[model samples]
Target: MPVSRTERLLNLLIALLNTRYGLGRGDLREKVYHDTSGNDVAFGRMFERDKNDLRRMGFEVETLTDTGWAEDDSTTTRYRIGKDSNRLPEVQFGPEEWTVLLLASQLWERAALGTAARSAVRKLQSSGSLAAVELPAGVQPRIKPAGQAFDDLVAAMHARHPVAFTYLAGSTGREELRTIEPWGLGSRFGQWYLMGYDRARQAPRHFRLSRFTSAVTTLDKDTYTPPPGFNIREELDTLPELPLRTAVVRVRKGRLLALRRRAADGKGVPPAPAEETDDGGYDTLGLPFRDPEVLAEEIASYGPDAVAVAPGELVAAVRRRLRAAAEFSASPKPRYEFPGAGAGARSTGKGTSEDQLQRMLQLVPFLVHNQGLRIEEVASHFGISRRQLESDLHILICSGLPGGYPDDLLDIQWEDGRVYISQDLDLTRPVRFTVEEASALLTGVETLRGLPGVAGGGALEAVALKLSAAAGEEGRRAAALSGPPVTPVTPAAADMHGTVRDAIAGGRQLRLTYLSPQRDSLTVRDVDPVRLYSQDDVWYFEAYCHLVQGTRNFRLDRVQELEPNGREVSATVPAAGGSPDRLFTPNNGDTTVTVQLTRQGRGLAEDYYAERVAELPDGGMVVDIRFGNTAWLPMFVAQHGGTARILAPDELGDAARHWIADALAKYDG
Candidate 1:
């Protein structure tokens, strides 16, 4: 059986740690890496690689040289890890601090951040310095960006490698091959962007990861050095501001409330001359937008609720796009080809490189202070496998100050499982946080501050203080300038969240009176709560429902009553699968409901049901959609008024008619 890299490294570490005297190359090959024992050169190379890996992970391998000490009177060299330098100091965290860290870890419970957070939590748990605390429910803020481009770009940026990808240009709507030296990665307005030096353009440019038409492939490492004093945050800050244009639009009364609130909150340009329509059902308002095309798309998405009154070009653009969509749906053959079909290639780089780099920077100082620790203890402290630890150490041993001199390099030693750093190039302290990192932390803390459990707590305040201190003057100023405020949780919902979270943690079942929005009725359920998550401001409890005999997501706000049952949850629940988009996906055995939508309802088909559109010759659209449950279909049709009507499934049409009639009866009453 072939031994895996991780297994071999683990075996090597175990052998070294168990032995009092470090084993020589011959002994190591025979005792640990027996697979390579036949080839002396291969064994030597593997041993060297393993030693470098250990050094990279901040392990100090001490070498003992003795001549005439052996029976053969030959100079023999023995290796051992210095137990003094490899251990991390025992650090105590206060309850508030622990809570803050816990909240921080929870905030990053999805993407790349989640991986680091898990490792950190593991390390903390293994140390037994801080007791584990239950995190608050409805406080998890996960950032899961689509595609592997972001991950690959981040790796290239860290490794100083050039990356090549096919990017769909926003200006031309054309796919073009781009080779760039990735300098930094950042997120703005929930979109990830890669800032890099475009090789073709010979200029710095920013590429939105979503626009990538192909997988990112990392080229040679150290392709080009970043210019001195190249600060990604500063570059982002210096980006030119987009010019805003005023747009006059008419919106339906009580509709577009979110937009009005955003404008009121000073998040966008103020609207002026907002006049009520004669029918008392519409309002005319002037809104400002940076991109007329983007604004047009937004207005189009609102269906008949919003319409562009002025700016003929914007109006024409929206109409043109809608007409094109309608025409495309009507065609049996392909009228237009999609731009990003080449995105099927696998991404070359891994996501964990950036996180590893950050950890390595912190590791230097940790090893410098602690000095001597056992290999296993060091690996556990860092929450890494022995192989990974060795790989990291290897990288560190070859890394040093800019001079590249022997004395300038890091002097790391590991012998007989113990490790130490004998000579350090003054790399004892961690590098200062970049602007993006500080901003991200501030954003995370601000988000956590709105959660019921974290709000009004000293933990957030303490965390904020530390973040501000680390951010320095510029970062502090950036953080001080607040973005949008977090949506506050309802008191009832907050209480339910606590109840469900506790039940899930304690392995107890829950009794809940849940208000079914679709059925417009209340139903009591016995649930074995599994996971608690939140999207935007809405909290959901993913539970194994005893009533349904399957997992279901219960909206916390819709839960009328929640009580923890004394019975322990005995049945094991399967893990939650699929993306966030899965919530909107129809079940396999769902009924296909067809609907004919008028031109005014074109936006609905264009935006929400893009995959279901079949165009009619008269500028209307027929949408064939699958619904897991048709309970909410009536209300959805009624909301669109006469613009949409069910064409198939007579039962659905009858239900929609009944819903409209019920509403009319209420008005009559």
Candidate 2:
């Protein structure tokens, strides 16, 4: 079997560490680098390269020459890693510092930094430096999930290899093959983007990973290099701006409150009507958006709570989508295949070998610090199988400096199921965070700080200072350049946040006086806390609701008053059913309403109400949709600007007409 480069490096490191007296070139070639035993020059070059790599990783490789007895008159040379100088200095973290480090580690929960963070945490845990502090359940911040191409692209970026993939163009909706020299990857507004030099376009281009239509294939040839001083963040900031259009929309009371906050400036538009809904619940506001399609999707997601009021073209576009959805829903699965519909790119497991090398590098240092750890304990601590640990140990034992001899390999002991590293070659130190890793952690911490009640504390500041120090000058600069901008939190929201977090941490149920936007009413309920999380700057509490008799998500902004119930949480709260995206599902009590849509509204029927649509011979469609409450249905129909009409359920039409008449009454008045 052919040995891998990782195995070869492991063997060399072990050989160098085990020898008290260094072995000569011939011994290294024959014993350690046996594959190159016949080629003296190749072995010499490989040995030199290995030594340079180790030195670059902070190891000090030393060479010594000794003259044999006068009879022989021959000089023998040897090399070994300088143990004293290469050993990492002992450093301890205070409790607060440890907590901050843990927070930083948790920031990389799902990104490319995951492996490094996990290894770092394990080392810290094994050293007993972070034993006492527990990470809060609610503070595990996650960035938007990256596409399957993420790992491959990161590897290609590191290796300076060009990559080829089929991408769906956002502008034309056409699929095209693209080859690019990937410089860097970054996240903005919870989306991963690749900043690269497009070989075909012959210009720098940024592509969203979600736009990729095929698996990323790295070319075997390493062809391009990124320009010096190129910054991903700077490139993102310089991207061309989209033209904004002001849109008049009628919003249900308390719905889309965040958007209301964002649009407070009015942008020179006329003041919005103060007219409330028929039940005195809705508010009409003018908002600005750059992309009508994206805005349409967002507005549609609001169900009946929002309606497009003006910009006839925008209303038509939304109506067309809603009609398409309705038409598609009525069809019994037969019908047309939409363009650009295909299975998503499948994630590849090609990064395992690279991850293993990283794990070994970090594992050695941890083993050195915590000797006599059971194999199971070590394996569990590193989050790997025992078999994998044993395999790594096998590789380490056979590894050493270029001179391949019995005494040149690493000295590893796994006696009675406990692991011990007798000789570490002074490589027993966790690798420092790369600039990107440090920047990512810093960005996550910054986002956390912006969350309600998270900042304005000495602990967070101390954590930031320690992170900046550990990241070094390069990391500090990168973090400062790329981190997300902070958004200020309201005082009331901050206070409420502290109370909710405290309740969650203590396993206490909370009595909350919450305003229900859908019902347009204020109600009190007892909720057993599960976790508090944020999506798009809005915080929500996922809890077991005593009123609903099931899990529910309550927006923090809508929480009027919160008080601990003084009762311990007795029942186990089940994990949230789905992510925030699918937080709401139609229940048994929702009313189903059928509607008739004209041919122009077919798009809306197919796209928005597909699950309940039925196609008609006249190129029109009928859709049956379920609503928990009919309060916003009238505005939703009015948003279509009359392309769709209620066909069945006269009560729903009556409610919608009444709401629209009231809105028109206010506007005409």
Candidate 3:
């Protein structure tokens, strides 16, 4: 019978690792393959593939081509894996550094990098010298990778592959096809942007992830190599932020109060007298805008209640979005699936040999350091099933030196409920971190710098230096590939985080001087600290307020001042809800608004925890969202421009129309 692939690979690894002089193709075929490769051609192909696989797993398999210096030399080429290079160097870190490293590991959250970050951490933990450290309660920070698009883009970037997608242009409000050699991805101004070489444009361009009209399609790996020393962080520095400009908008008197307050002066006017329009009295305000698209969206959602009067671009954009939203409201709603309803189409999380090999390489060392662990516990740590772990243990028990003797193989036993690795065949150490592994970790840590009070002051830099030394050249390359460059929280904000962390840890009450934008007021209140976390790089704390007597979320930046109120928290605070994805908690009396999201606005479905009521044919979604108030629905529909419209609840739809109509009536001569 033909030999199993597991046995063949294990045998091949044994032959290569045990060889003093490099083994030639003939010797490898005879000793490792044992004629199971069918023929000479098959043997050669198998050997080449196996060599590449080992190299991909971070094993340095050296190839030496004979130079005909010896008269009796018959071997043309031979291969051998360097033992020292395959084994990881000793890694040591103090408690402070470990605290920061642990913090970095959690940054990826559920993003694709989370897996690599976790694996990298596991390898570090297997070093047998761990210092116990814990990050403070309620001080969790995470990177939000929106959906499948982020995973695909990050994968393509790592592989150096070119990607094709339909991108929606902001300036013209048009969709166009783009082929990009992705250099890096980062967030600026609360949005993710891809910096890449546009193949058609033949120049570098940045594309927003939300504007991608179609799913990203990866072309080929190694399509083009990025320039050496290309730093994603530095490249982002050259790009200018959206320039602020002013827009003249006419508002229905006393209506669109939010928009009016945005540009209001002391007298509630922009030095222009109020005039009566066909609908109601109108007041024109000089509204400052950084992006016409955003401004247009906000105006259009107001329907007839607000209108842009000046800056032809803003006026036209606002009109276009309002018209589209009005039209969509008149159309039939489509069907949509709930978030997890379509999960069957996703991957089953099966591990390939390539994946399994990497895990096992790390697993061996982890088991060496941590002996007598439960089989299930080991499987859980490695992120595999107990059945898969058993299969791996079986394969490992049969792997070792070329002789195939009992002592020649590894001695692994788990028949007694707990697993023990008595013999490891000199594979007791983890391998060096691969480029991809090191890159994900370094990028995560780099992002932590943007978080205030994370990495605990000096620990971040010291850990970074030590990780660079441990990761060596791979770490240097990782430095070139960067994630989003989030602006560091202000020094005051950092101090605020430190104070909030202490309060939450101590279960103390805090007196906060806060500015409430909704109320347009500055007030001081005593709030019992509960949890502190961040979503989208914005820090917020949930606390029970003495005035409101309910838990309310306070944005860190909005706080004018914060000090402990010198009292232990009275109320029994619930454990901080782990994830901060949804900052606003909905009330029972809130209305459930069904809305249709198309193109750019589709992200709102996830942002608001919308239930998939329907799906649209134009690659859009119809969802039902429970908003604390229907008052904000008009702004929501318009802010997404034409991409979102109120689908159900007739009165809410009428509100959108009336708001737009009043705004447009002001534009009439």
Best by TM-score: 3
In candidate 3 the C-alpha lDDT for residue 32 amounts to 69
Error (Å) of candidate 3 at residue 258 is: 6.5
Q: What ranking emerges by TM-score with the best candidate at the front?
A: 3, 2, 1
Candidate 2 stretches with Cα past 4 Å from truth are 1-6, 15-29, 36-92, 120-128, 134-138, 145-348, 397-418, 445-493, 513-524, 548-566, 571-669
- Per-residue alpha-carbon lDDT of candidate 1 for residues 1-669, written as tens digits (9 for 90 to 100): 665464455445434544467766666666566654377667668788887666544456666667546533213777666544544334455676676666655454333434544444433333344454545432354444333465456556644689998876767756799999877665544345677789999998887664564567789644877665455555656655555566777776766764554344433564455565736466777777665555655665454556666676666544544443333323343222212334321111133443565566566666776667787877876756788788778767765433347875668888988779876654454444443344445555655656655534476777666556544642453332122223335677777877876776677889988876444467899988776766545677778888878667788867767898788875576533321322333447778877676544554542233345555555556666676677766656644444566766878877665655533332233
lDDT of 3: 0.72
Candidate 3 least-lDDT 10 residues: 342-351
- TM-score per candidate: 0.48, 0.59, 0.72
Total clashing residue pairs per candidate?
Answer: 38, 53, 17
**Model 2 C-alpha lDDT versus the unseen true structure:** 0.62
Give candidate 1 misplaced runs (Cα > 4 Å): 1-5, 16-23, 44-88, 129-137, 168-176, 201-203, 220-241, 245-669
**Order of models, best lDDT first:** 3, 2, 1
